[model samples]
Target: MNQLLNLRAQVVKTLLSVQQGQSLSTILHQQLDQIAPKDRALFHELVLGTLRQWFSLKALTLPLLSKPLDNPTVESCLYVGLYQILCTRIAPHAAISETVTATKQLGFPALSGVVNAILRRATRETEQFQQTLNQTHGLPSWLYKRLKKDWPEQLESLCQALKQSAAITLRVNQRKIGRDAYLTKLEDTDVQAQACPYADAGVFLKQSVQIPELVGFSQGWFSVQDQHAQLSASLLPNLDGKTVIDACAAPGGKTAHLLEKFKPSLLIALDQDEKRLNRVTENLQRLDLNSDHVQIMAADATTWQATRMVDCIVLDAPCSAIGVLRRHPDIRLLRQASDIAETVALQKQILQNMWQQLKVGGTLLYITCSILKAENEQQMIEFFAEHPEAQEEKIIADWGIPQTHGRQLLPLDQQGDGFYYCRIKKIA
Candidate 1:
């Protein structure tokens, strides 16, 4: 219990730091690494859940607070406590008492009354309080307006989807084992699972379980990956026995998928950070997909030059990650509206630079976990306009998907992430 409390305190501190202008994930990494393994996991759940539902919780708790908590640390601690009352099944009394005790430990004993009162009110009038929050959309005004304007028909569904917890998915490593054999092995171990539609070897877990507990996990039968992220590999046609580049492929999820499926002649996984590249190597090593066929390089995708033109290229450019707000709520709070322009520019530079490396008739898969039109459709539109040689292949909307310039898969669906992908072929 002390371990949990300590980790929770660390998460609260990290949240406070983020509120005070520190990088969200960066500030939490070392603190999270210091906790025990199980505590670390719980810390992640609590912090992520709390952040994801913050607006709603705040709406309920604010009216009950006598005044603003004033201190950021105390405010964050109160938010954490209120989150437990509203989201978790913890006994209301224990949640309140323990959290108030935690505040005292954090040198905010004076605010215990405020915490106790707000949490007690939250528990007592749960539905009424929640209804008020729910009616208001539980999002920042700017974000709510943006969603409504962009997806008028689907805004409610999209917002609700973003509020729910994300599903656990696995990217099966076909290099070591077949998908069916692995599914059977998982079922035999009492793990409920199903095959994801988009990827050849992807699995959707019916329940959340630790990755290490899965059969053949240590042997690398599969690695955790969203079904939506696997789309990049599927979009690349005729990849077998050809050279390919996975640009910005750190922690190489897509890189491994490419290797597992196509077993390409040359797979160069490039990312700017050398340290993160270690995760790519680790993932490949576990999948038994690590081979002379693949090369990990540390270089910026925007500037990296290939010695010879490759048959295919994947530029999974980084963006605001708005499409995945449910999984990473910190992103919504972390990003500013202006960040999209710079991201689009960088993506253009990488696309133009890497387009040079793709031989005529070769396809470049441009993908991002972003739902914004500027980063996805508008970027692709402008790209196609500038490069008359490239043609836009629209992903059909009758597929029960939203329309964007390219393929815009909502995070709500079975086989998609809030992803945007365009398979641009270079004309000779």
Candidate 2:
């Protein structure tokens, strides 16, 4: 089969069962072995880029055609071609010719006339075309409207930020090596590194580098974490040798950071998924920090509780992950307006359950990879109403991109995921 046909087949096969909450990159990686390495790279780039800028591309292509292309096969074929011409650095002629040829090869030879006419018009009407594309394609109207309502003053900036790619940040595991020593080791290998200002152990790469290949990584010198997430560990005050709980800890990024920062007397890490929790074990084992100092349990935080009130608890509540859209483009297509309500309810339940496990004067740092008010600010507001004893700590005022209730790191800026955090202290 031709490269384009193969690409289309993969795209269709993946999207066929595109359920909510599945990772786009993980799905693509599963099918990667089928295509040539070069074509696989280009195929993923086009699929993700087209999804990222779907609003923009459809806006550009719609005017040239009389109406929407209803057939999924024809529409995807068109997107395969238009996405290349508009988004990629591929020469317009090459993009158009190759895409048209692929349509014929993929059992749509009759649509060649339609594909040629649309692409030719797209090239000919460049200026008027570009403006329409911008007006329509830059942001999905539903998301744009919601963001505008929520962040009136900063909506434009937020939209721009969400559209760009996220930066790769690493949290240095001080158990094996300090930040300065890690940087020197990286520089020796010609990897560019810069300190992430907010967290002591955090570092930003000038270029993306594979983590396992870096020196000390196998020994647990560092792990990939966003600067915003690294701050989640820092928000817990008076963490020294205390009993701390990382409820809903998965892949153990935050749990490992907590282990490093607090060196807590007891660190109980709990996650619902056994497979995902194994990831946390892997991270801990690699760093040599997975000791009797920590306890890993495959349990749901919504109901799980310690035998006694712990010194501190980090409740990284689940929510509509509208914030990390840049890193996971699949969310843009899979998320629905209704998903927010269910997420809010789940977050609320977990918060109430986890808060009960916190001892007096202990802290519960509520966090989410979400920008929605229903999940962040509004949820916090409701929690305060129910529990008058809980008070907002307001730990880091300027840790991330500014938001009304808590700091939100935009994915577009700082090259980080969109994250929301609010810390609460129990006084009663």
Candidate 3:
């Protein structure tokens, strides 16, 4: 009983940390080691599950409280308890008992009765609670309003997509193994997977497995990348032996993909965070794609200068990351409406700086993992006016909706996260 109470308390603490603006990933990485190995999975599930339906759960529980709880930890405890009761197959009695015990364990013994009463009331009103949740859209008001204004026709479907969990997709490293051959190996092990429709090298796994335990993980058969992200490399023109730069290239999935697809004379994988650049190096070494031709550097994209004009530049600029909320649900909590302006400013700075490095007639593929027009189509319109030398290169693709300046891929359940892409060429 003490062990169960400790585990539940840990989950409440984690959720409170996230509520206070810490990223779920960073907290988990730092604290997972402290949890008992047997309890880590439950702790993860409770935290992630609660976050995924945070707004919905909040709506369901708030009505039960006479007034809002002053203590954030107690509120988080209620959310964690409510999530398991509604979402998981766990029995309501067990969920209520464990949560009530955990409230006392968290040094709130006086409030244990409050926690027990609220959870019991919730269980008794399960049908009514679900109805309330169904009416709630599960997104903060600002985001909901923004998305509604941006995608009026598709808003309902878009909300549904963001509410669900994302699937595991992999991009095969063709330099090491063929897609079909890798599928066969997975099938031989009774691991179900299928080829992705859009990307020639993409595969979708039926179930999540420990990545390193996969058939060719150690041999670098593939890298986990979304089907949408895999589309970026093919969007650019041929670069058999041209100079290229992947700006903001830490955790270098696209960088490695570019190296595999085209033998660029020089490929500079550059990012501002020197510590994150280690991930780029590790991925390159794992895929055996590291070579003298590929140079990884730590430098701000907005200020970094190329010694020579480059044939191509892939600027995967940072943005609000709204498109990936389903995969990173904490984003719904961490991101704010006011953050968009700041993100747009930084994107403009980097775009202009990277443009200077492109030779006349060289291509610059601008990309963002954002669905907002302010960060994508609108940003491009302003850039075009600022730089007359920039020419729009229409991406003629069957996927994604064609925007005035780029293509917008909406998030889809069990498929790809939302992403945007535009190609531009410099003209003298």
RMSD list, candidates in order: 2.5, 2.6, 1.7
- The TM-score values for the models, in the order shown, are 0.92, 0.91, 0.97
- Tens-place lDDT per residue, model 3, 241-301, is 8999999998899999998888999999999988888998889889888567999999999
Candidate 1 CA-lDDT value: 0.78
Of the candidates shown, which would achieve the greatest TM-score relative to the real structure? 3
- lDDT of each residue in 31-65, candidate 2, tens digit only: 67777876876776777776776666666666667
- Among these predicted structures, which one has the highest lDDT? 3
Residue by residue across 252-271, what tens digits does model 1's lDDT show? 89888888888688999999
Off by over 4 Å in 3: 1-5
Query: Lowest-scoring 10 consecutive residues by lDDT in candidate 1?
Result: 395-404
lDDT accuracy of residue 189 in candidate 1: 91
Against the true structure, candidate 2 reaches a TM-score of 0.91
Candidate number with the higher TM-score (1 or 2): 1
How does residue 28 of candidate 2 score in lDDT? 72
Worst 10 residues of 3 by lDDT: 1-10
Residue 163: error of model 2 in Å? 1.9
Could you give me the TM-score of model 1 versus the true structure? 0.92
